[model samples]
Target chain A: MSAERLLWYTAVMAGVTYLIRVLPLVLFRREIKSPFVKSFLYYIPYAVLGAMTIPAVFSATRSLVSACVGLAVAVIMAWHRKGLLPVAIAACAAVFVTEWLMRML
Target chain B: MNAAERRQAFKTGFFDGLPIGLGYISVSFTFGMMAVEKGMPAWAAILISFTNLTSAGQFAGLDVIAASGSMIEMALVQLVINLRYALMSLSWSQRLGPEFNLIKRMIIAYADTDEVFAVSSARAVGGKRLRFIYMVGLMIMPVIGWTGGTVIGALASAILPDAVRSALGLAIYGMFIAIIVPPARDHRSVAVVVLSAVAASCLFHFAPVLKRLSTGFVIIICGIGASALGAWLFPVPEPDCKPPDLEERSAHEC
Candidate 1:
């Protein structure tokens, strides 16, 4: 992409994103009182994060099998309430080792 | 807020945000590499990260840019993929204290990524409202880490071995899991909501018509659908008596 075109792309992307984020924060000044609305808002994080994580994680790595192994390790570590860095490191390590083994085979 | 309290909130938020910063580094690194691979200049990649902190939105935008898609297409894609942040920001609006003015709201809203929102909304900094100073503290490291990673990845994508880069890509997902798992384990409602989202995502990915939808639209549908279902199934009981702390609120609902 040309520099001008890239600049426009980035600018538009940034503007749209910023508008989405800021509009709600600025408009809704009062505490939300509706239970259903509150509950829906409460669940947004889990739903969005879950939707973003799955299937995508499987495709992030070079091999699906290694990705699965990495995911398993990540889930296990997370289940045990491990910190973020440790779980990430363990998952990365798992993928590394699994990929190495597969290559050897 | 008092000066001492403001300092404390900032300190606490900064510390809480450190891990998220680390996670952002790995994730944005992949983004930078992908941008360069698609023929974008290194500076443009960094500029993308600097200007737009969103992960999925940027990725989708990159695809559109590479296709030489129209500006309207790019705007629509970003709007859809990032619509969830609007919901998140709305939720956060209620959490902000009276102290948060328009300027502060706009500034803090800029850094309201998924992880940042998850951490900030879950934990009560001082009282009934989210501390503005604390949020500033939380944003500092992630911004640095994200921009720093993009610069490195864009400049050095060729030199980094595929093995290491691929492995590092897992960090973003790992961070997502880390954010959700604890709350899921603690609250049944959260767990069910997460499962519902996963199911909806799978349906969108595999089903015939739904599979044709863009990723941004699919995520929007899944996120809203699952959350609405969760809300219907498990509505918070009277809002008046609810605890200020979200973690406590979940436990109380249970």
Candidate 2:
């Protein structure tokens, strides 16, 4: 992509994200009232993360098996409520080891 | 706040943000490598991190840019993926100190990321209003970590071994799992919502007709659909007591 186009897209993303973050802080000082809206907002992050992780995660590494192993390690560490850094490092280590073993075999 | 007090607040916020900054280094390092691997120039990848300061949204946005998706698609993808910031902003706005004017609010909003929001919210939870200097103090380290790490990652991508580079591709997804899994484990509603999203995403990925849709659309559809369903099926119950106003909340804590 051209530098101009990349910058344009980046600006669009930054603009929308900024609008989302800033508008509420400036204008919506009142507490939100609706239960359903609150619930929906509460779940959006999880849902988005979930959707983004799957299928893509399974292909993130050099091989599907290694990726699957990485995912398993990540899920286990995360289930234990490990910090993001630890979980990420463990997952990467798992994939690295799995792929090494596969190469040796 | 007095000048001395402002300096102290900035120092405290800086230390508080240090750990989050440390964490961002690792995640954004992976982001930098992935962005370059996807054919972005080192500078351009770093530019995205500097400007966006969001993990998922930047990664998703990178995908759209790489795929040459429409501007509309990029905008919609970011709007959906980063919508949580809006909710966090709204929740935290009520806790802002009287001195937080329009300009300060706008500046703080730029750094209203998930980790930053978490730490700031905790500071405000006892009814103490958030301070402008403290918030700025809290954000500076993480911003440096995020941008600096990306610069290193983008530059190092060329020198890193292929095996190492490929393995690191899983890092962002690992971070994503770290974000969602604990919440899902604790809350059945969250678990249901996450699983439903994964299922929907798989359908879009593997289903012949649906697979034709771009990744940006897939994320938007699956995210909105699953979260909306979760809300319908498991609406968060209202607080038992009347939620106290900001002053009342502080008074009760005191």
TM-score of each: 0.86, 0.68
Clashing pairs in 2: none
- Candidate 1: clashing pairs of residues: none
Binned by DockQ into CAPRI classes (incorrect, acceptable, medium, high), candidate 1 is: medium
Residue A3 in candidate 1 has what lDDT?
Answer: 88
Best by the DockQ measure: 1
Location of the lowest summed lDDT over 10 successive residues in candidate 1 chain B: B245-254
Each prediction's whole-model lDDT (CA): 0.81, 0.79
Clash total of candidate 1:
0
lDDT of 2 at B38: 94
Candidate 2 per-residue lDDT over residues B66-126, each given as its tens digit:
8999999999989877876776687567668888888999999999886777556545633
lDDT, model 1? 0.81
Off by over 4 Å in 2: A1-13, B1-45, B54-104, B112-146, B153-156, B240-254
Q: Supply every candidate's count of residue pairs whose N, Cα or C atoms clash at under 3 angstroms.
A: 0, 0
Which run of 10 residues does model 2 chain B get worst, by summed lDDT? B240-249
Per-prediction DockQ scores? 0.64, 0.50
True contacts kept of each: 0.76, 0.79
TM-score of chain B of each: 0.85, 0.66
